[model samples]
Target chain A: MKSGDYLIVTLAAIMLIALYVNMWSAPQQAGDRVRIVAEGSEPIIAPLDRDHVYRIHGRLGDSVIEIHQGRIHFASSPCPGKQCIHAGWLERDGDFAACLPNGITVTVLGRNPRFDAINF
Target chain B: MMRICHGAVLALAVIGLAACGRNAGEHSYRLFVFGTLVDITTYDAQRERSDRAVQQIEAAMQQIDHDWHAWRPGPFTELNARLAAGETVTLDTVALGQIRRAAQLSATSHDLFNPAIGKLIAVWGFHNDDAPSGPPPTPPQIYALLSARPTMKDLVFGDGNTLRSTNPSLQLDFGGYTKALAIDTAIAILQRHKIHNAIVNIGGDMRTIGRHGLRHWRIGIRHPQQPGAIASIETADDECIFTSGTYERYFEYQGQTYHHLIDPRNGQPARGVLSVTVLHKDPAVAETAAKAILIAGVSQWQYLAREMGVKQVLVIDQNMQFHATAQMASRVKFEITPTPDLNISKTVP
Candidate 1:
């Protein structure tokens, strides 16, 4: 309980805090799943799988669409200019994916539904 | 007891601080240059070797730039200016040798990897730092400038530094292959300098000279759409990895995107693919593979990779999906978290 001992403890605490912050702030971990649903359609469902990474290929109408796992998002599409793809990834619930070209809206539903059938 | 506690704390603090200062044994350097190689190596001897190699490369770049740039060479600055004037310039032995090798590869790639795109690039206003502010050029304007532009075949070489152009409008630009060529040239330089192990990253075009001690060079392929996101990391022994993507240098107007990678099929920017990374034994091959894959677009990429017999490649499409050749998947040693969605389908074989 000496004053010098208090100083040492405080220094060690600060160092630990700094280390924790550095580790915590280091980039987002990769397992977060992002879902995309095509608007007006029967809810086009795509889920990003952790075991297998998905690649979004080609354009959806005017919007560039990416599907990974079971999730889908707009990568970049050539609608009028290509404003949607430039908007980047949407991983959170309630995030809306829009493709002006096809009038497709991909919304991320909070819950991911399990598939009853597997299609080749 | 109090003294013991203070001593323990001091010892622990010293250990922690020492750990912070500990060198990883491997080092990296990043250089941003319009032209010239930015060689990064682990050892001091290798660094010196890279320095010498870059010196020669800069000299070679200057030689080619002088032959093509609009500043001097006056009227000769035009594409095929030398041929039009009927002047045959004697190239140095190194230039002649490199050009011969590059020309042969250019021929093989069906001019898909043309070093002669200099004239076309200049016409597109990319050579200038301050590009002309206006709408993109019309098709007619593009055609007028590039219609009669020279092909790689126009370049003819003879004994000594002597080079001739069969066409009067053929301009020689080495920008496309120069960096990759520099990697090869620098490796050669390092070999001559007796330095064995190094890594040369000329603006993301990476080449590993030799292994650093027991460890191989591990390079990460950056995701095209996401900045600071690594698509995959691969280990290499002595090979090189070259990547060309639409994201590199691009400007958006209204809604259209204009990037640096111009499709030779059309004078406009290439679309569909976000990025293309090529793994090859030589930097030059990697460079060509990167360019060819981008030009071929997404659907044709697998076909092209198979035809070219390139074992390793990573292509990210506009949809933000990742596609890799079997070779690329095998080479990957690590993946960053939130690994981008990847599509792994067999190339027709």
Candidate 2:
């Protein structure tokens, strides 16, 4: 076989290994994005690295969410229970906090989520 | 010829990599129902078919939430009112079926999962969506309700759809049990639509069918004290994972936290355990067992789990210690570092 053919075969083998490594390697360390889903609206995805406060108008009222230092939490919410605020900060992948009455949820998203759902 | 073969090999490699695009065939829809978020995921399905299944699931779940609302002015509340007024009520077939199943489960848990303590639940101020910020009920109030000793046994089912409660205080609150029913209903809808691979997650509790493409669906049990999972489990087909935790629904009062998992035995939040997670194929059984085990506390969880036919169980005590059944220990991978002192106990035959 020609050296060009051999090189092509070698390149193909290297490419296959690279693809496998990309697919099967360890999941990235922590969540890098926050996904917010509110009723009657398209879900919003934002980078986790930026610390900011955002408000989404929900069924009950506005739910105030805060992103601080690579973490997210419900700063305040119109729902009577305030359970969303009580959920504290969500910094890890697959972690989520929801205001049921208000119909808003904040979830951390990463390359490979740790679980399909979190059972509390 | 050799060069052509190499080119073919490279072409196959590229195609295989393209096929491995993450989430290529995954479709997910989320809705707020049953007083919480319901997530429906379908893998390798046509978009139209998955959308139709999700639409039906949303409609069915909304119907259940409306028909069975415990505190709201609804059919279930009307039934409770009639039962309180010493009137025999004829229930619809669906209501009758659910009540009968809940009663049987209550018996199996030895009344630790009593749905007849609705009066106690109300007295604790948990009957509403508004989190109970307690000036907790006085002991006299709790004792007065406790003295009635209301239970599912108090409900007399007389011939076909007819029912009555002997005790006026015997109100009905399905709580987690009803959520389980909703999950099951969602699964049934997905199956009817021919969506074999899916996960139905109501709030944090979930039930999974088929798989996520190639592997079993992975689930995380939320840590009561930490941000991430306490442990992870790879679920088999038609498996339901239910957890009852102090963190789910609770309020703080006078420096103490009171959750909504009311114990019929004490007419207060079940104490001594932080959380309990149960795995089983039946959603209702898993849901009721998680509640019963949490109420059973550390000393009697195993006995209660055994009685309820729940082989996989995990309990986190007040001290942050993990107690898992042998079956559960074999299935769960603890995600915590140094794996906080897990004690494995035998699930006796």
Candidate 3:
């Protein structure tokens, strides 16, 4: 191939690679993020790979959510029922646990969520 | 010519990948009402139209919440008071119609889905917004209410749609029926607003109007004993999926759990079934059948399901065993690992 033609092909390949990286990086990271939505507060999206305890102040009181080894659950919540605590750990994509009385919820976000909704 | 061909292929690839991204027209609105999280998700809808539909749904829900609340001071409470006083009270058109339909359903399910057990539910301390705590109502308390046998049949309709109860103990709490009614109403509003592809999810019970773009609306059924889903299923358009689980509302009494789903025959929390899910064209029917079948327990659930004309039914028993009808078995993709014990029953003919 001529030098000019080789340069054109190389430039095209680099452009395609850059475009692919720019477009796909966000969603790949997004699939590992867990979203915590509390009423009257902005939703907090954090990485699932990192283990952390998040304190969200909801309507009733503080709800303590913990992420450990790619799974999340309500460690402690001030709601009367404690159904949130009983919900145990949520690991899979589209898995969710909500403290309804406390007005807080934790849901695993992914590039392609497996289900539109969950029925209990 | 080769360079031009390469450029064309690259352009096509970029466009195709961009198109694979999530639909731009999809919208999800979340609200907390009716004592749980309500999610309204619309696909391929204009933002303005979706907003209007959601606003209308919120307004309708507020109206229903005010009118149908059993514990609060509202129209429904007033109706209960007048009924208890033995007065032939004239009910509003909507309430009257719903009560009439509930009565028919109650008779068909043999009163398993009785709304006339409001007094019993109140005594169990489940009628309030806050969760009930500690020592459940005593045996004497339960027996006294059960002795009255306040069935929906006790409600008698008089002239001008006046309702008088033959048994004054017949208090009305439509807890099992109201959420489903609200869902049906929300779907209607969405349809009116020209939003065809949508899902109306009130808490865990929901109804879908159309597909999620190319595929059907798929959902996960929550595991009664554990976190995550026990199964996932694809829901067809205009299908109502309702699940009644003992874990929804409950009180721990001396280490024993007492849930809010009172079995009309015994006046205590229903036992032997952890959850029951039903799929039907009518949300009311689906919800009512779910509650009825759960109360019917392991031995009698199939009988009630057959009577209610519900073909797709899934029941998780207290033992953690899964029982499903043939229709449900065919569609439900069990997600539980180690392959839990699943017993698929014959189709309800």
Candidate 4:
């Protein structure tokens, strides 16, 4: 094959691969960070790109939070049921989980948040 | 051309990697316990630890429900039986503590918030899970009950956790206040475990501790006559928000519906009030005040609120008008703009 033909083939393959990733392999890149909030406290916005773990002192004691590769989840919590931890990873715009006993909640926000707040 | 192809491949890879992740925020969990929704939200980051914490909290709540359930064959039920049989019964610490607190509340509310009217509740078919087939008891039957007038004062509490009742007709029923006590106990448990921020919502009522980040906990007060929430309030730290509505429990008979909240004085459903919501730091007080104020009816509800020293309150009357205390008017942030019927003046209502 000619060099030009080779070049065209390679570029086409690369473009197809990129399209494939966007369509199927990758989850939506919409949400940028996870917002951590506890009652009567300041919000902690954690970057998805920066891999780190936070020890948050909520009303319920310590909630261990982990952020890695644009995903966030509870690593440990003071609540007895561990439901927040079991909720798995939150990686969507406006996705949220809360340990009501601990009085802390995690919500995902992109450039926009889905809800101002849930009523009732 | 080769250079261009290489550049394109590199750019493609960059785009793919850029799309690699998703987003998340505040963590929340919900459980159906105590026959109502127990919704919890937390900001804790550790997944495993959070799960453990939630499981533990749920377990404690279930235990509380089991021990104190009025219809269940548990500790509280046994205590009731012993009291009915005129036996000098020794109550566990939990039951005894509740009795002591209830004694004080009953006295303060002048027995308008009495828990010793279990038979009256049963006569209204509120004690059972099934719906009532017919109308409420006849006037003569209710009159028979009124002759007994079993007040909290009739119950004797002595040393050694022993309890005896002077009135045979008196029966203890904690339905009016058990949920509030449950919330208070759950918060205490969470606080003891070092959870500084938490909310325990049972059925529709709730108690919150600490803050939800920069803001206080926002709770919605359900409308009795309508679908969506009628009003929203920001909960103060360690505050209890309780609402009692005739809408909560009712049975239809002929063309009318009879609610479970019978006025102790009339031996019938409290009239002139549709619902009452109370916001206070003490869950026990809020629960008692909500019931007492509802029984006091519209014109007299303000007196009960003043006597209880409750600052924030909302009362809905039979006329479909809402009355809010000055403190409530200042504190509540309505989800929807107020209409004409939602009047703010207590005196006007």
Candidate 5:
């Protein structure tokens, strides 16, 4: 085959690979967001897709929140129990992590959640 | 105004669908009724059909709430009032069916699941709009009500739907089991509308019809001690899954916990069994059986399950020991199995 045809084949292969990768990994951005509610204040809504820290100025004190790769958690808090961090990752809808001491909470939400009903 | 309302809703629905794109095959509608979240999820390739089906099911739930609410000033309240007044009250067809079923269960269960203890329930402070808080009814307070000993037998089912209570203090309350019937009614409405893929979740107890798409419905039973699910179970097609737990409604009183699951026999919070999960084809049976088994405590749960005809049952007692029926053990996928103290038996001695 000609040199031009070889170059064309390699470019097409790379393009196909890129398209397949984008299609398969797209649901990660399925508009999955988290609602962070600070006690005595309106909720601070943010996207779960982005990796960032939200220092919520709560009534008691500030709470440092973290969102990493479509998952969220209390990276650190001033609360005594540290139960919020122990709650681990907040990745699915209705999953909640709260530092009751500092009066801060994070809840995951999306259109079609994993569980239809949640029992206590 | 009616035409305008219809047109506006149709426009919003169309706009909402277009915004979500054609690939969105699943639709979810969350409505709050019966003082709990009622979520309707349907998997239909046509989004519009899913939306309409959910609307009809939500309407049916609202109707059930209006008709059967126990304490609210509705049909149930009036019936209880009439019965308490010692006057013959004629029940409608719907009321008669529910009352009869409730009465039969109350009788056969040895009053362990009696709804006729409305007065007892109210005296315990459970009749409040929300979960009863601390300072539970004192011993004297409880003894006063216990003296009456209200039972379903107090109600005499005369010819047809006519009913009268011999005990004037007797009051009928179906709060214990009406959610189960509501769940069943919601499923029937969805099926009648030819929508097979749906889930009717009342409060936390739920039932599903058909597959989410090509897979069976999956439910996660929440652990009594934690914030997450302890085990997951794949539901049989059109199966009803329910859980009765102290965590559902309770308050701490000087380190002691007082829950809302009042034992009809003694008129107090059931002493043992943290929670019970029952899976069956009938929603009402699954819920009622779970309640009966939970109140039965660990020592008698196996026998209760047997008498209740519940083949699939999972129970976690106050000691955190996990127990499952052979049938339930085969289906449960424990996220975090309990400690070495696990009971995998048909019955416990």
Candidate 6:
């Protein structure tokens, strides 16, 4: 109603804005599940039957790769030249795994009937 | 007049309340140091004290880098180089002591965590940015160099820092343990400066000296293949979380891949196990666990952990399956993708 009240209201609005910005600016949540496969290891077909998709965590040399859903990607790898994590995710079904350092191979397969045996 | 008086009183009250909220215990400060610890947070009785403690720790880190860095020529470095060159160099008591301890560790680990891999790393262009633009060295090249590699036993330490190496090609590289040593040194410096509560994270190596308010330090383990992806979050009291993943270094050529973790047995990058995280009181153990897990592979890691009495470790296998020790399960909460089949059983420790 008065100049003093208006100034107080303005300051309160600014404080609220700041609080909201801080809360929203928090770090993004990582993907729900990560499937890490090593090179020469057998291809594992974990069920993607659930509506929730999964991510592939593997290495391409020293760089780590994270393939979210069906896309192949890099998370973090230790390669001296970190070019892999930047390569983005692989979308196709038969795409080669992005990780090479630990001889890791990752792939997304259709949910199979045999998914029940492998425990998390 | 009455309205003005009331406004003045309200402003004073607001300011007083704001001032009261700024009490000593409410504020927390985080310190970021690039070397030794990647990130650390500390809170002190006063902001000034916390800043002073950080400054002192930074100074100590610089000193550690100066003395222990393979690129630098400190007493130990000079002595190690001279020993490799067949020239006898006098050593100080402190240098001799450190060498002796390092030698024992090298022997105990059976050279898995060799402190003498500097030349090999340099040849691979790990130290220099202008690496040779070509395919990684062939298997034969790696093997030839590995065969001639000097054993830790070749190092001969004596009183007065005098030392010699039987192999002229021996080059000391403390990459594996130097960072841990720096963390210890910084902790000591913080204690000396009378700062009791601090968390030091050098890269992914973490050390928490004391509690934060009533809560333990919470650390998130980055997923091996996911950049900025946290696979799990764990809490520790006066412990450190040190991790090493296979993705740390490597190159790909023609669909083939090469990584930095060389298997001592075959002179090629170790296979299997995406990442290894060790939780313990000693940063060195965390460091050693990372290296050892890479060398030992996934199946052997569990046995090794049990034998070594290492309580906490998380190993993600090649199948995208996640496995954690009992201790790790207790400390870490996991989020599995595609919903892993959860199985919990105690293997003999």
lDDT of each: 0.59, 0.88, 0.86, 0.74, 0.75, 0.58
Q: Can you give the lDDT of residue B263 in candidate 5?
A: 85
Q: List TM-scores of chain B, every candidate.
A: 0.78, 0.93, 0.92, 0.87, 0.89, 0.83
Compared with the true structure, what per-residue lDDT tens digits does model 1 show for residues B1-349? 6765875677587657544433323343423233322435643353444566556655554554454344345423543566656677776786577778778776666666666666666666665533223356678977865677567787778766788877666666665576766567656765676666667667567777667566555555654654333544534567877888886555665777677777766677788888888878977777887887887888888776766667788887888777887767766543356655566658633
Residue lDDT tens for model 2, B165-277: 89998999998898999998989998998989999999789999999878899988888986778789999988999999988888889998888998899888999999999
lDDT by residue for model 2 (A1-120), tens: 777777777777787777767666765544489999999799998878899999999998899999999999999998877878988999878888888889999999987776777777
- Give interface RMSD, per candidate: 14.3, 3.2, 4.0, 11.5, 13.7, 12.4
Candidate 6's residue-wise lDDT over B1-349, tens digit each? 5555566666566555444433323233223232221344664445566567667777777666677767655754675668777886676786566666667666655676676766666565555322233466676776776888776788877556677788886787766577777788777766776667677766557677776566554555655665333444534556777787766555666777666666666666678877777778888767776677657786777766665557677777667666777767765665435545433327723
Model 3 regions lying over 4 Å from their true place:
A1-26, B1-24
In model 2, the Cα lDDT at residue B146 comes to: 97
Residue A117 in candidate 2 has what lDDT?
Answer: 74
Greater DockQ among 2 and 3 belongs to 2
Which regions of candidate 5 fall more than 4 Å away from where they truly are? Answer: A1-26, A30-32, A35-46, A49-116, B1-24, B337-341, B347-349
CA displacement after TM-score superposition, residue B223 of candidate 5 (Å)? 1.4
Best by DockQ: 2
Residue B317 CA displacement from its true place in model 5, Å: 0.3
- TM-scores for all candidates: the values are 0.62, 0.88, 0.88, 0.69, 0.77, 0.67
C-alpha lDDT of residue B284 in model 1: 75
Per-residue lDDT, model 1, residue B147, is: 78
Q: Evaluate model 1 with DockQ and give the value.
A: 0.03
DockQ score of the complex predicted as candidate 3:
0.46
Predicted candidate 6: interface RMSD?
A: 12.4
Q: What range of 10 consecutive residues in model 5 chain B has the weakest lDDT sum?
A: B15-24
Listed per model, the TM-scores of chain A against the true chain A are: 0.43, 0.73, 0.75, 0.67, 0.67, 0.37
Per-residue lDDT over A56-117 for candidate 5, one digit per residue giving the tens place of the 0 to 100 score: 87645788899999899998887654656877888876676666556676878775555555
Least lDDT summed over 10 consecutive residues: which range in candidate 3 chain A? Answer: A22-31
Native-referenced Cα lDDT, model 5: 0.75
Pick out the ten consecutive residues of candidate 1 chain B with the lowest summed lDDT: B28-37
